[model samples]
Target: MEIRWVEAFIAVAEELHFGRAATRLRLAQSPLSQTIRKLEKELGVRLFDRNTRSVALTPAGQAFLPHAHRVFEELELGRQSTRAAAGEVYGTVSIGFSGALNHLTLPPLTRAVRQRYPQVTLSLAVRVVTRDGIEQLEQGSLDIALVGLPIAPSSVRTRLIGREPLGAALPVDHPLSGESAVDLADLAEDGFITAPAESGSSLQESTLRACVKAGFQPRVVQEIADPYMILTLVSAGVGVALMPSNVAGIMPSASVFVPLRDEPTFMDHALAWRPDNPSPVLHAVLEVAEEVLPTPRT
Candidate 1:
């Protein structure tokens, strides 16, 4: 009638001796006998041939053995499948990022994830900047994120992965491009391309601060969201922009990427996830990110 009763039936059927079956099941002989009796009563069939000297199975009991074993095996397999589905080694992850990450981080990040978690399907969304990415994360849209700025929300957990030094994008024919290294101040009179102030971009803020430190408030000529567009503007001599050194590697043609004289206004890159919604897969991905990011030099 119950699974325990089925187990008792199987035990006595296999051992043949009442005392031995009871011992194997860690039960008293009386209870094991009662359980077998109950199972036989429920099934309305005799399962054992009993004599004073020995016990043997009925044809029905022999027929039921394989079915009983199969039932238990199927149940265990179902439990194992559920656990595997919940494990870090399985499942899909969705990630969002500011456009800059496409050029500076995603290529390597994608390669690493593919190599390590080939079964984990990764989905990506291109965003304007850190603020946009964080908003998506908070809305339950992103499982993980690669953000370019500091995340202020206490509910959002993060890890600093790497830092890239700020560099300037300029036209090859521009006056200052001839210099081996250009001071941020040298472009004080130049028209500038920048992301909007309210965009919450750390790079925009850092670039502005660098200009102020170099002693001028930059004259804005264009406001663009995508880094590629910024490079296009520079290529057309529309204006100059400050970006991470990695951006230079993504350019299709030679513009000019000069190290800022200050040489290290770094844009910090971070891996972020929601603290409220913890995920084992996301945590594993974060670990991979931390492991792959370039290490800081002393």
Candidate 2:
């Protein structure tokens, strides 16, 4: 019933390959498949058929594709009328965002924009990394990006949105996990898991720097990009991690997040955009973003 479901169906119908469709849509393949499954459940029809090598749309999908296109057209027409009535900014603003921003930031900002500018569509891409975001913004593929700070220098302009406290992620069975808070120095003997170093991932540096400030260089056991997967590894008792505290509850059952006890480390988060890019809709969205999630000066 949702437009996103229809959009997913259309993407798969056109691409006929889930991997390529997910790439085109800027989504992970698994979640993209889940969306298709949800749509099939809603409509009570299989949209695609495949067996390891190929995908073909079902009769229902071929029939549904054009109607899905019409659905967007009709919505745009309605939005045009609404924009004319309200004199609101009208265009699409594509965004690239990742990490804790997904959980703590996007919804309220998207909702506020929907109320303020009915004609403006916010195209949000998830699972984007800091490295990809920086390149994408410079390449003009993204109007804005919400990313962790201390990123590689680019001409892109940024405004600090918030600061997040860093903490240790440990297996629930670990001795330190029982504490209300654990001192960073106390984890010197534990092996660590961290973000990819080549990606200019802020989390990687945060983990290393925080550990250094607490007096020991961490022994990194693994490098992974996905935060949830990182937590998965932690839950499996691989190693401890220093991640933003907001990510605490993601694998809470097996992994316990213990706040860093002394002079906790903080990571900066910001919204980045190219100054030369001129998009009124992008500017409007930025304005709304500032109003809704103002830069937390600290």
Candidate 3:
């Protein structure tokens, strides 16, 4: 009737000898014999034909053996399923990341998660702006977010991942492209292609601030939501743009990236999540994030 009872019966049925079955079960021979007797009595069916010389399964014992094996198999599967649901092993984590991080922080974080937590599924929401990523995190649609910092929400938890300096994206043939670094003030007359302020992009805000500090408000010629598109416009000579230094790696082939001179400007990036979120999969993802993208001191 009980699982242990069925286990004992199966052991005896398989082993055939009471002493051998008990040895296999780590139980005493007498208790093993007594357990089988109780199982047969409870079922009102003779399970094993036994005598002083030998022991063998009755036809009924053979039939019950397969069922007993199935019960153990099912119980094991149930335990595994429960553990996975409880977040011990497998679950899905939804991560939202801004377009600026596509080439910078996103790749290593995803690679670490895949290598270390193979059982965990990573659902990525890419090309998300900092503001939208935070909104998604707040709405419970995203478990984690990689965003540029200065997040205004008090309910969100954040950690500073790193700071990257803003660089100028210019047409390859531009005269200043030959310079090692160009002053922000030197580009003051150039029209800028940038993310819209309403897009909630921290990089956009940083760029505007840097230009203002350099003694001029950059001439706004165009606004694009995606970083790559902004760079493409720069490459086509439509306008110049300021973007994270890492963007240089994935910029349009005709665009040249130049660091700003005499400017100590940097766009701080961070990881954000809701404080009240209790997803175990998120914790696993954070673990991998820490390993791949460690926080830098401000």
Candidate 4:
């Protein structure tokens, strides 16, 4: 019920040993045991299944662990917000960026936050994919992340900030590969390699929508998860990849990516965060990002 009770529970839950948890909390073992007993008594459940040999969390304890961490997160947020309201905006914020599209706003956003709040520290983590960023955000390891639209969890809030135009990835020897610009309909009959529709990836959706608008449903020959693999498949003459054209220099040769000539389809990029997060440091960085790259509300 008390703050010290929550602290004791978390320490014990993490260490799984009364003595170790007490040492971590800088409290005597007897008192720490008493704290756990009091918490268990109040909750009317055994949080741990322990014997002299080893210790482990009970089913109830395992379920309660995440909620306990959330309690701490909320308290920390309150403290940070209070400090920020007092004109002391100084806290660490973790940001996750997976793709190059986020780079357009990262530098300017970082500079603006540094100038406005000299005390804040920005922590950057390069995630391998948008799903990785979204997972980190849900786990509370990251304050914000660049994610594709329609992420799985509704708990995450998003603000659209950028849109990268899509293009066709075709084999070098393909007839239309020589064109300066290609239309989506031109590839209607061509074999297509796309991301699975279940992934909710903007790349696949944009490609499909553009193709449908261009008067054809693509002949999908393969569905690959990784965009790089999709490109590699295209390079091998498997199928044309209608994806973000901006990723030209990263992959190997043997394929040509050209701009879409018809109504341009774009892969959307957005900044995603938990709405429950009250960290003033994250709020400050988001403010700067909103200003640096503004987009129409979706």
Candidate 5:
């Protein structure tokens, strides 16, 4: 029988009063009684026994009540499942994090998403270099990326998430390591380990700019992409390097992080995503980013 017929049967069976069940269903008693009569006719069994003043379920109606309840229960469950699947923040969000830069913003952003949009799944891609992270975002492999600033190509939209002073990574036994803060000029004669110059690395660019502003050109001895490798080399006294202060968390035991003395020598980290990409989950993530990251000053 139809769902409406089953619904009427269950309501009337539960209430055992034609007038009360019709009021509960927001239907008139006449139509409700007719629907029950039609359902009984379709089943070829009397479902209720009623006189002018009272109504009661027949044996057949009692037998069908449980099954009718199951139908409505199952239908409601289906509707709830469909609504969740169609929700705006229900899908997976693939996030790409540049090496070491994640320390500045990834934790709070992911935490905000988890607390606010429980249905969204987070798939994180870590240790990706800034340039490569941007490429993955462009290719649709990543929905969001947290990377060092000065991103290339200008096609990706970005929101500034953090700004921190760059620090010098030095061997613990080195004389310069004892100082509270080291000057770029003092390290002018020292060998420097940095990321690949050809990788469009923002850290490398900031380092070069700061050294140039300090009236010296740094002597480059090694080019490594990973911050941990850079720290390992610094610990071995291979060379000194300039990195964001937050990289101190991953510094090797033999390496010590010291703040830089120069003013305006800061590294900027930002959240990048393609403007044309239209994932609803991505939009939800961006909202969380805005809430977690500091708003830029006018």
Candidate 6:
């Protein structure tokens, strides 16, 4: 009947050992066993088959497990919805972003949040790598981040926004500029620029893997921290660079954009927040991002 009894029943059922469940729940075994007894008494059924050496769930307990899980899930959802309606908008949310994300996703995300929750001040922290974003999130400095996946932490709560296939950008005068797409192997001898590995970007690692998959190690002509600088260098004919398809719209120039053939891979972009401290503006941001970008580029 009570939430604590439900919790106690669920815990013991999961552990299948009263003492172990009590230890896991941080309570004395005697109290836990008594709580389970009370739960069984209230339900008017034996929920467990217990002896000195073993414990097993009764048929009724097995039947009730799914219902208990659903109850907890619904309770949490109700709490979040209630908090959302109350305009819990005074918390400071620190947000981090990769460079190219500003052009592809930030505009719509910002507009929606500003319109919906003006009181929740967002502190923008732009960084070049996904690891930087993850570190900030773990340190409690960042409440949210728009990160390129393959770099985000598994522990963080993430919602996918979009993905863009890797594309080649070269100056109009470059030898391969006339083609609509190029094979990664063909650019083996060409000078390449990418985000440096030291920046802790998984995109940087993916680039390397892409080249390796194409049976070559890219000739590193330069390592630039910002996506804009890489585009600038490519435009200057200093070298070629691999960029997300969405970045092409922002880097409008004489650079010819072509999708990679062998490594037709994409960088996944997502909005991440700490699971424990959910951001108040996140739902609005997700709505805007979904509306603006329902699907990734082909």
TM-score of each: 0.68, 0.70, 0.70, 0.76, 0.68, 0.65
Best by TM-score: 4
**Better by lDDT, candidate 5 or 1:** 5
* Best prediction by lDDT: 3
Scored by lDDT, model 6 comes in at: 0.77
lDDT of 4: 0.81
Model 6, 72-157: lDDT tens digits are 85675566557678855443456788766457677777766777667656678876367877777777678778877765336777
Better of 3 and 6 by lDDT: 3
Better of 2 and 5 by TM-score: 2
lDDT against the true structure, per candidate, is 0.78, 0.84, 0.85, 0.81, 0.84, 0.77
| Per-residue lDDT of candidate 2, residues 157-235 (tens digit) | 8888879899989998999899999899999999899888886677888888888899999998988887778888999
Model 6 earns a TM-score of: 0.65
> Judged by lDDT relative to the true structure, which candidate is superior, 2 or 4?
2
Q: Give lDDT for model 1.
A: 0.78
Q: Give the TM-score ranking, best first.
A: 4, 3, 2, 5, 1, 6
How many steric clashes does model 3 contain?
0
Could you give the C-alpha RMSD of every candidate to the true structure, in order shown?
A: 17.8, 11.4, 16.0, 4.0, 17.2, 11.7
Give the runs in model 3 whose Cα sits over 4 Å from its true position: 1-87
Clash count list over all predictions? 0, 0, 0, 0, 0, 0
Candidate 4 per-residue C-alpha lDDT over 1-298 given as tens digits, one digit per residue, 9 for 90 to 100: 8989989999999999999999999999999999999999989999999899888999999998999999988887788889888888888988877544455657777788889888888888863356767777788899988777756656789988777778888899899989999878878889999878776456777778889889998888999767777888888989888877656655448888888898887788888888878788888888888787688564
- Compute the lDDT for candidate 3: 0.85
lDDT of 4 at 49: 94
**Between 2 and 6, whose lDDT is larger?**
2
Q: Could you give candidate 5's per-residue lDDT for residues 107-202 as a string of tens digits?
A: 888899999989778999877778888888887688888887787766789888778788899999989898998877899999999888887677
